[model samples]
Target: MKNNDMLKNILVWVVVATILMTVFNHFSTQGQSATSRLDYSDFIDQVHQGQVSQVIIEGQTIRGVYGSGQSFTTYNPGDPGLMGDLLDNRVKITAKPPEQQSVLMQIFISWFPMLLLIGVWIFFMRSMGGGVGGKGGPMSFGKSKARMMTEDQNKVTLDDVAGADEAKQEVGEIVDFLKDPTKYQNLGGSIPRGVLMVGPPGTGKTLLAKAIAGEAKVPFFTISGSDFVEMFVGVGASRVRDMFEQAKAHAPCIIFIDEIDAVGRSRGSGMGGGNDEREQTLNQMLVEMDGFEGNEGIIVIAATNRADVLDPALLRPGRFDRQVTVGLPDIRGREQILKVHMRKVPLAEDVRPSYIARGTPGFSGADLANLVNEAALFAARENDKLVTQKHFEKAKDKILMGVERKSMVMKESERRMTAYHEAGHAIVGYLVPEHDPVYKVSIMPRGRALGVTMYLPEEDSYSYSKRKLESQLSSLYGGRLAEEIIYGEDAVTTGASNDIERATAIARNMVTKWGLSDNLGPLLYEEEDRGGFMGSSRNANVSGEVSKKIDEEIRNLIDRNYERARQILVDNHDKLEIMTECLMKYETIDKYQVDRIMAGEEPGAPKDWIEPDDSIPPAPEVKSSLEEASEKPKEDLIEKDMSNDEVKEPGEPKLH
Candidate 1:
């Protein structure tokens, strides 16, 4: 209580001191004014005392007295107590300088000018810092404004991005001008008004635009396709106007709109209420880009995966002059990309970039980075000093397939069946000339598969042989046959659900698309559209009689392949026994292990396998009467581009 009172007392004294000083300053100023102001009463009193002084009249000096020139007889001085007042009444008038001009009057006028200067100084300082944007003025919004990277700000020359070499050549001419504009102008060669970058996501479209900005050495204004759009009706158009205005001010600038198809899509064609907004925005962009009558130095660079949907106006000649394609790194390109990413990691001594490149067929720059990171993680887990080839192998498999799941439990009986199932696939792939070679085989669960057989075509194959296709079908049936011949047909389940679907589709396509049938008369049964109902949905005529012929041929082919699989399994009963035995023991076997078993060399089988008892009945020849399964001409196997090629680099995988 005492402390609070003492604080209150100190505050009160401070307030009193402030008020007292303010009152003293006001009184002092008043006294100064009063002393300097013209004092008629003082002059009258002086005249009353007979102190002589001549006051100026309209054009002459007057003696201030009752009868002096231009003097008033009755004059009572108004009280100017704090402002030049005197208590005298007499006739006195003055137009000339007073005889008693004081020193206070001169000093007071000199300091009054500084008082006015201080008030103006405070007002201007406050206005400059006045947070008028609800946030702040330009001073406070420094960081909020987007950074403008001129051509000189970046270091990624066109040479940095390796895969899109073709695109670089096209956009380079624009860069030439930004470097030296006079060279092109002298030759009468016009600059590209716009460049549209088209490619799948992560193909480096945006990066290419950055290169353009870097080369031109001009102001680069970058925004998204959706940036122009707003909830309001005219907002998008307004933003387009504003953006172009900014660009014109900074002429010879590059404006990059990433994913331009967002608002520039064929408007009024979409099922929405924003046609007014979209059409307005796109039209405004067109006018701004092409400029009604004047040539513009503002170059537009846009990017989109869906170039097909862009507005026709936006894609017109003057708008987006050239379209650049940034595609995925092909094999040789992938190798180069791998080389770039490889430089960042502490690679193991034996890890060759070429071998890694070969193993990672279709990796993008991002995928290569991930591969390195995965290798690093594998190394760190085992406390290895470097990223070993073994770690890379594991990483590659993990990336293509997924992490191995040894702990995913399966019954011993089920496990034996899965091993045989995968073994059949490995053996068929190895024997078939058209199919890819088996890379690895494992009974370890990954995703939903109880087992997986990994294979990759040795080279990127574009076409398949019919003989190869027939071999693959036989392999596809091997698992079921192995189950049936041993477990008496009841052992088969729905595990080959995926395999059946794929085989059926291929057979149908062979008949309908490939024209691969004898009785079907080499006629395609169906026609699928390539683009927009194959560009036109005109009627394609085919007689009903011809359709029946195709169906009969397809049935005949399926029956023939089924019979072939049964016969092979029967004759190779001994080989089947070796495979199942190995499967029961190890729960897995690679191509080398399967080959060893076929060559009569005992595989390094697991200890826990229950060996087949010697008393089991042998499998008989499938074609006991008819004979000769090998003599028939088989359809070729189709090898797909199934390299880790489709497994894109890790990022927001662009659906485009």
Candidate 2:
């Protein structure tokens, strides 16, 4: 490297010197030509006329100053009378021999520029041909772009990762194989040549791969799938070969490829047959992974969110033998991830990881890390010494619902309408059987909405039952229904546009996808998939009459839910009004206040509300309603076990 840099420097200096010499030669030639040229006859005529003042004679050249003091030059014709003529004319005469340049020096001067240009061209060509270092040049295009980190460089062990315990355990055997390959070999067991980590983005797939490398104490080679491909044909294949060769050179090393879907998409499924470069790259990778020529000690780990798009051949037993799912963390996993990120922040005594985790269901590892960082920033903005629970609450709310649009001014009438709309959603969700609890409701503008009502599930739910989905559909219609009841149907605003769309989609899916409608039977009536490289295929073919019936079923489902929501709101109209009034006063209200309003009582002040300190003025607070109501007593609230029949009557509020 040092030699190459020194050579480059020397070349630069040589070019600079050549340019300077060329400029100097040009100026010197210009100075020599300052005297105008004169014909020999003209000079002789001038001397005879006594117009020449002085002359300097060389072997065949004469330079002289005319009577007017202008300098001129002429060539001599070897006339013997020239000297006598000059003497007779009384012109000042001096004679000397002509100066001669060596043949070699003249040739060197004449051809220097061409030689310099050729030398520069050759230097650039050599540089492009990877003459300096075997990286980044066109000649090195076939070389792998994978970055290698020695065992000592990677310090991310499994302990550093908190949410992806299952992924770690899945790859643990690979680490063992790297540590003691003989143990597996003795039992006629070969380690998996490739492991594919499948997950959504930011779920710690890359982190898990690094942890595996750390655990094995082996070299880690990392690259993106897109890096192998190029505009040129066959380059991707070459890169794949080169990458595998490098991994083989560093035996027992782990190679991690992120976003493999970029190059691993199913072949022959694209519009114009397929991408040749990408397909070739995927083919080479498949061969290198588990080919006839065994790569015994190399382990290839790849991560992708779109596993469905990958070539099926790549997922076969010999290639990627195992697939580890790095899914979003559950509640417990989220709590652990929160704790991991919380370690870097100065926390107040009120900062509880478990509580934050519960509020942030379905959060990935990266999301939790960001949450912790956001909380820290919130604390820093307030000039607080420690991150408090309120900070985390603000961060979570911002992430979930988007930043508050506090500066947005709404008319009092609109604000009142928003309050009623949100209150309707909260009340319907609270009363509906099999529905998640109404976590909070607010009339304050947030993101694109003038009001928001949030729901929180007590536990992580992987699937929804028919009852739960029906309840969700009903709750979705509650807002528009509330508007219709408060103001006549024609007075309803477009604020419930999103709610109508969601509710319609749910009802349609219930009929078409979920087969929840009795008329649809236990069959799917969904439209054909319009995504993916290959052409779409309809899941089920229905006659035109059946399609009409399907639409009818969807409409019936929506109507039923809409009426259910309307009836629920009408039955609790007084409670709804009370909740809306509370929302208008507070701008936001939590589940505790919601429960009090539903029970036909005033919400009053929050139990956890504290008097502001007189000595130190309070900074602006951005606490979420959930966090504000967390301290409220919950012993008397309605229990989850309450049956739907218990509150079927109008004006009867269900109590625990």
Q: In candidate 1, what are the lDDT values of residues 1-656, reduced to their tens digit? A: 98995786577568656755865685584323222333455655665565523433332223333333333322234433411322233323455443553698667656655754664454455446644342235333321222367656676666666666788888888988877889988999888888999888877888888877876678888888777666656667877777777777788888889888888988667555445677777877887877664446888889998888787878878879788888776667767666666677787788877677766655666777688889889999999887878888778878887877877866555666676676666655555556666666677787777777777655544566667676666667666665554543433667777777767666766777676765565665676543455343222376788667666766676667666776766666677667767666666566577667767788775433456676977565344211231122211111222244344568786776
The prediction achieving the highest lDDT against the true structure is: 2
Give the runs in model 2 whose Cα sits over 4 Å from its true position: 1-134, 272-275, 527-539, 606-656
Cα RMSD, model 2:
10.4
Model 2 Cα lDDT, one tens digit per residue, 1-656: 99997898798878778787876886485328446888898888889999999998887878899889988888888888988999999999898887787999788778877877886776776656655446666568788999999999999888888877778888889999999999999999998888999998899999999989998899999999999989887899999998889998999899999999998888987654554788878888888887789998999999998888888999999888799999999999999888888888899998888888888877888898999999999999999999999999889888887789989977667787798789889989999999998777878788988889999888999999989998998998899888777665645789888988888888877887877888778787876574734645354677998989988988888888889999998898888878888887778788788878778777985554554468976566565432233223323221212234243448777798
What TM-score does model 1 achieve against the real structure? Answer: 0.63
Residue-level error in angstroms, candidate 2, position 275: 7.7
**Where does model 1 exceed 4 Å of error?**
1-153, 215-219, 272-276, 291-295, 463-481, 508-656
Every model: Cα RMSD to truth: 16.9, 10.4
